[model samples]
Target chain A: MNSVVRYFTDIYKGVTSLWTGMKVTGKYFISPGEIVTEQYPENRATLKMEDRFKGEVIMPHDENNQHKCTGCGICEVNCPNGSIEIITKKVPNEQGKMVRAIDKHIYHLSMCTFCELCIKTCPFDAITWGQDFEHAVFDRTRLTRVLNRPGSSLKKKEVKS
Target chain B: MNEEAVKKVILKEDEDYIINMGPQHPSTHGVLRLEVCLNGETVKHMTPHIGYIHRGMEKMAEFNTYKQLIHLTDRMDYLSAHINNEAVCLAVENALEVEVPERVQYIRAILDELSRVASHHLWWSAFGMDLGALTTFFYGMRDREKVLAIFEESFGSRLLHSFNTPGGLMHDVHPNFRKHTREFVKYFRKKLPDYKNLLTDNIIFHNRTKGIGVMDKEMAINYGITGPSGRGSGFSCDVRKVAPYGVYDKVVFREILYPEGDSFARYKVRVDEMQESLNILEQLVDDMPEEGGYTAKMKPVIKLPEGEYFQRVEAARGEFGVFIVSKGEKYPYRIKFRSPSFSNLFVLGPLAKGGIIADLVAICGSLDLVIPDIDR
Candidate 1:
């Protein structure tokens, strides 16, 4: 008789416990606007990434097609994976002395882990992280991008002033 | 009733059933295969099969520089990625004898606690689903998104953030870091009662979890279970309290323990921990210093002195320890990661010995084994 009474008590407790859980869910069910999920494709136009988002590396060039990269290969060395390659060419400066200058700043998007090592280690502050995350390409060669534009030169102090 | 007839009948009785639970099954969580031997519904004996996802991180650590090695730790316990990174950084810093600023310590603590809450939320969700209550999944993820958003805003990546460098953060946190963290704390506190109502107080959850997979204190210590799982057995094994790191010594928070030593006890430890994490966040946000260098004056090249250095940090899961054997080179000579899951996963065999097959899933979920951390 005691066991039978305890069984009924257990059933009562279980039902009430389940009802409490249901009430929490029921409140969310009635409010249609409380849904937190964003429709990703439809909201692409207004989708804003954080300012510090490490999507991809880019070399910032001025209006004169002059960049700050000295092609010292610090970024290339610091990179855990060999994602950045600095191809240097001997170019005569204003003093007529041949010095190493960046011929091509090759950035392989496919190989990059977006670890921000290059940007953090750059002595020249030439490279910065871009906001473009859509890097899908059908061709593999398309990802091996040269960061500095063709015919671009090193930015002069006068140009900055 | 003769001897030959009796012997034949005994031999002809069915052998114990053997079954493989997972290397891909959802309940196993990651690529962990349990070769479970069963008699009727009860598990007779179990052997865990690992190394499906082993990337040989320790061997790879030998080739990479200490700074580069910090990123590799991120992949080990990807849930508590920041804390793993901190372990490596702390080991390197301690070896180099660099003094990390108080501000850095405070910020690291804040981030650690935030990740703890996020980790517990996911665990709670997944544990519920493992026990056949699917509603907890959506609620857990919904609340977890806010914390991940905070991580995404500050660290620039949501999940595997190698934010810690040798002595300090790679960069200072976002200007709105404190504001977002405080808001998340206030917001999460209100929502926690809903979590309790939905799962903690539910009788179905209790029936599924209570008195299942009982691991006593002696067994937990013997098996080296070191997180909330061990604390569930009242082992007093919180690395934070044992060896305080990253402003943990300064904070006033209880090391949650329960002497019940069952699946439910482990579940309660994590649930109560989330509130304690909120308390930690509340204390940290207001006191964070406005001005400080994000990183210490680290040389461009880092080389640890000739010795073995170890660091242990209380990760979301358990005590994550990094052992570095340096030959005074930029790269460590040999690296060994004392990952929590590796120790914790082996206990499943002992815990699930007499429990039903369904209860095995509950025991495994309560243990909260992350396979990458184990396999790495």
Candidate 2:
């Protein structure tokens, strides 16, 4: 008689547990506002990324077409994956002394882990993370970017030091 | 009972067969292949093959600086990325004898719990999908996105945020960090009961999980299993409780345990742990220090003394330990990661034996093995 009572108790507990589970789902099903999925592509225009988002590396050029990079190559050395390469050449300064100048600040987007080491290690604050994330390209060569703008030169103040 | 009769029986048993479950199957989570031997529907044995996604992280660590290696740890257990980064940072901090600020400790502890909730949410959804309850997948992902959004608001990456440096955080918490965390805590408290109603109390879930893949306390200890998987067997291996680090000692939370040692018990432990994590988060967020520095001052380049250092943290999955040997160099001489999934994966073979093949899936899901963590 005791065994029979225990068996029925177990069945009653199991059934109630399941019913409670269904109730939660049922509640969500009736509420259309509770749906959390976003419609991709359609919502692209309104989509916003955080201010601190690390999308890609870019060298910020001032209005005078001058950059902060000194071709010191600290970022190149600090990059764990060899993603940044600084091409430097000797240029005549205002004092007629030959000084190092950046020719090309090449950045390979494929190899970069976005660890922010390059930006953090830059003494001159030459490079920073750009907010643009749409970098999809058909060819692999397109992923390699020259950060220095065409006809741009190093900031004279930075070279004076 | 004669030798001839036994020989005939052996010949008839040759119908038993073998099958390979995955290197690509969704049920295996990541790239893990299980070689299973079966007699009709019942599983006789299982051999797991790992390393499909191994990127030689430990070997790669030798060539990178201590700061650069933090990024590599994130790839090991991608779900527990913050905790993995924390383990390495803690090891380095201890080696250098650096004291992090009070605010850093509080923020790190809060983020650790948030990552735990996110990871367990993913596991719960995947577990439900493994059992043919597809709706749970959508529900779990929907809730998980809230946590990811919080991560994105601060650290700027949803999955792999290398946000911790050796001394402290890479950056301070966002202005809205406290407000958003409070909102999430309030929001999730209302939703957690739904999780219990939807999965924990479901009769079909109970029928499938209860008494299946039973592992006792002795076997769990012998196998060196830690985290919720071991706690399910009543082994009491919560690293946070045993050896508290960060603000773990300061906060109040329970180490969830269940003695049944079955699939249901393992599932219950994680579900209960999610609540405990919420409790911890609430306490830390409410009493966070008003003002402090996010990072401590350090030399541009870090070099540890000539010795060995080991630090362990309770990751979302289990105990994650980092062993560093430094010969007073900028780069570690040798680094070895003690990942929890490797030991937990070994228990699958024992648990799955004598159970039906379907039960094998349930058992593997309960263990919640992250393959890259095992491979690392």
Candidate 3:
């Protein structure tokens, strides 16, 4: 008699459990407000990425077309994957002295891991993260960007004696 | 005898056949191939072939600096990327003997719990899909996206955020970090019951899972199966409780355990653990310091003293250990990662020996094996 009683109790528990599960799903199914999926490409026009998003590194050029980069090559040295490369050449300064100046600052977007190490280690505060993230390119060579513009020069600062 | 008779005779002689499940099957999760020898639908034995996704992470770690290596750890257990990053950071911090600030510790603990919850959410979705509950995939991902959004708000990247550095975090939390976390916690607390109702209470799920893949306590310990899987078998291997790191010692959360040692028990352990993680997050988030330094001051170049160091942290999957052998250089002499999924994958053969092919799937789902972590 006890065995039969236990059997019915077990069946009741199983049936109730399944019913409870269905009720939860049913609630969600009826209420479309709970739906969380975003329609991609449709919302692209208004989609906003966070300010902290590390999309790509870019050197900010001022009105004078001069940047803070002193061509120290710190960012190139700090990049783990050798993503950044700086080409330097000797240029005549105001005192007719030959000093190292950046010819070209090449950045390979494909090799970069968005680690922010380059920006963090840059003593000149030359490079900062750009907000634009749509970086898909048809040709692989397009990913390699020359950051410094033509005729751009390093910013002039008063030398301390 | 014709070809049919000959084949029948050959089959009769052995009475068993072999089959390959995947290096690419959807159910296998990530590139794990299993060779199963079967006797009339019953799995006799199984051999798991890993290393398909192995990128020689340890070998690569030897060439990279300690700080650079943190990015590579993100790829191993991508689900628990933050925790894996924390392990390397803790290991380096211990070697340097730099005391991490209290704010950093609390923040790390909170983020660790958030990562745990997100990982379990993905596992739950995938596990339900494995068991033929297709809607669970949608439900699980829906909830997981909320957590990932919170991660993106502060850490910038959603999945592989190498936010944790050697001494502390890469940057301080965002202004909305606390508000977003509080909102997620509140939202998830209500949705958690819905998860319980949908899967936990379902008789079909119970029928598929309960008493299917039983691993006893001794066997679990012997195989070094830590995390929820080991706790399901009644082995007390919660690293957070046994060897507390960061602010784990300050939090009050139960280490969920079950003696059943079956697939359902393992499933139950993870479900209960999600709640505990929420509790831990709540405690730390409420008491977090408003103003403090995010990272400790360190030398530009980090060179560990010549010695060996190992640090273990409870990742969502299991205990992830980072072993480093330093020779007082920027790069380590040798580095190895003791990934939990590798050890956990081995026990599948033993657990599925006498079970059917369907049972094998159930067992694998319960184990929650992340193939890259195994491969690494």
Tens-digit lDDT track for model 2 on B1-376? Answer: 9978995654334565878999998999989999888888988778888888888999999999999999999988989999999999999999999999989999999999999999999999999999988878988888899999999889878899999999999889899999999999898898887788788878788889999999999999999999999999999999999999999999989999999999999999999999999999999999899799899998889999999999999998899999999999999999999998988999999999999999999999999989889897
Candidate 2: misplaced stretches above 4 Å?
A: A1-18, A158-161, B1-15
Per-prediction DockQ? 0.74, 0.68, 0.67
Regions more than 4 Å wrong, model 1 = A32-34, A94-96, A138-142, A159-161, B1-16
Error of 1 at A153 (Å): 2.8
Clashing pairs in 3: none
Worst 10 residues of 1 chain B by lDDT: B7-16
CAPRI grade of model 3: medium
| Clashing residue pairs for model 1 | none
What DockQ does predicted model 2 obtain? Answer: 0.68
Minimal lDDT window, size 10, model 2 chain A: A152-161
Better of 2 and 3 by DockQ: 2
Chain A TM-scores of each predicted structure, in the order given, are 0.87, 0.84, 0.81
Better of 1 and 3 by TM-score: 1
Choose the strongest candidate by DockQ: 1
TM-score of each prediction: 0.94, 0.94, 0.93
How does model 1 fare in lDDT? 0.91
Model 3 scores a C-alpha lDDT of 0.91
